[model samples]
Target: MEFDLDYLVQQLPALRAGLLLTMQVSAIAILLSVVVGLLGASARVLRLPLLSPLIAAYVEFIRNTPLLVQLFFIFFGLPSFGLTLSLFWSGVLALTLWAGAFQVENVRGGLAAVSPGLGEAARALGLTRWQYLRLVGLPLAVRSGLPAMLNTGVSLVKNSAYVSAIGLQDLAGVAFDRIASDFRAFEMLAVLLVGYLALVLSLSAAVRLLEHRLQAPFRR
Candidate 1:
């Protein structure tokens, strides 16, 4: 079979639109997941009574279940409970919660690595728990956990493809649609691989830059 350069060129507009949609969805989800990770990790580490145990249960549930099931439950099942969300928001919410669970553990591990002496010193210096976490502990924890956090971020971008299962016209969805109509499986699949690779590499590069900056103060 011949590679169809002209066919791909003709489909560029649709493909680009799909890629942009994926990027938009992934961006929103990544940002929200990071917020969830940090807050959840902080609460658990501080042992915030009811809230901490609830976060632990949430993390376990999300990590154990398949993402596709979660996606379906959000997109198809939630309407039964009168909590309907648009397709885009549903995808965003599912991805955010899924990735956020792993991130919570990743961040919690980093927080655990914080020296016990530091917490003691913080108290002796009259720094309240929240203040110490804000001013010192969280910064150090984030630096230690940056790699795992970014790994979850990269996975989040790739997993954005799952939104296509619900008929969201993201990159994978567009490829499947074009293949169904045009019968260009080779071309469409090839394009899908390239699009996802581009997204992952872009995210990895950004993560590396962030890691370097975060490590700078301790590089001496």
Candidate 2:
């Protein structure tokens, strides 16, 4: 097989552009997931009668169903309700919804790690419910949750590749296009495979650094 390092290098600009889209989708989805995680944790913990039950039901449904199916339903199903979104918007929205489902569990686990004494102390101090949750509970929970949230972030980035199937030119999509254009099938795929492994490995390392920082404060 003839090699073309220069040609591949030239494509880097477009590939980088695609990575930007991947990052955008990831950022928006992560923010949405965090919000969902917080809301789910609060509702489940406080046990608000009606809202609690509804959120519980939502979590169950989301966790049980497949994300790909959910994406299809939103993209294909929403149009039935006269709601249409761009492919990019649809992909981001679908991922956010799916990530939110799994994130509920992360939030619950984090909140559980908060020492009960802290909450009690806050209550004794006459902290308002909002103050107790915002100032006390969330801060403690965030520390305990760091490792798990990082794990979820890794999963979210990997899953973002699926958006390529729906016409979003993410990393995977760019590689696919390269294969079509160059006919360097094996070479293109090998590059793509290694690129993903590198991406995930680098992200996992960053997460480990963050986990270490979180643990540092607790060390005697």
Each model's total of backbone clashes: 0, 0
lDDT of 2 by residue, 142-192 (tens): 777877877787788888888887778987788788888777666566666
lDDT of model 2, residue 152: 81
Quick one: how many clashes does candidate 1 have? 0
Model 1, 32-108: lDDT tens per residue? 99899999998998899899999999999999999999999999999999999998999999999999999899888
Q: Give the alpha-carbon lDDT of every model.
A: 0.94, 0.81
Off by over 4 Å in 2: 1-4, 212-220
Window of ten residues with lowest summed lDDT in model 1 = 211-220
Residue-level error in angstroms, candidate 1, position 62: 0.5
TM-score quality measure for candidate 2:
0.88
How do all models score by TM-score? Answer: 0.97, 0.88
**Range of the 10 consecutive residues with the lowest summed lDDT in candidate 2:** 184-193
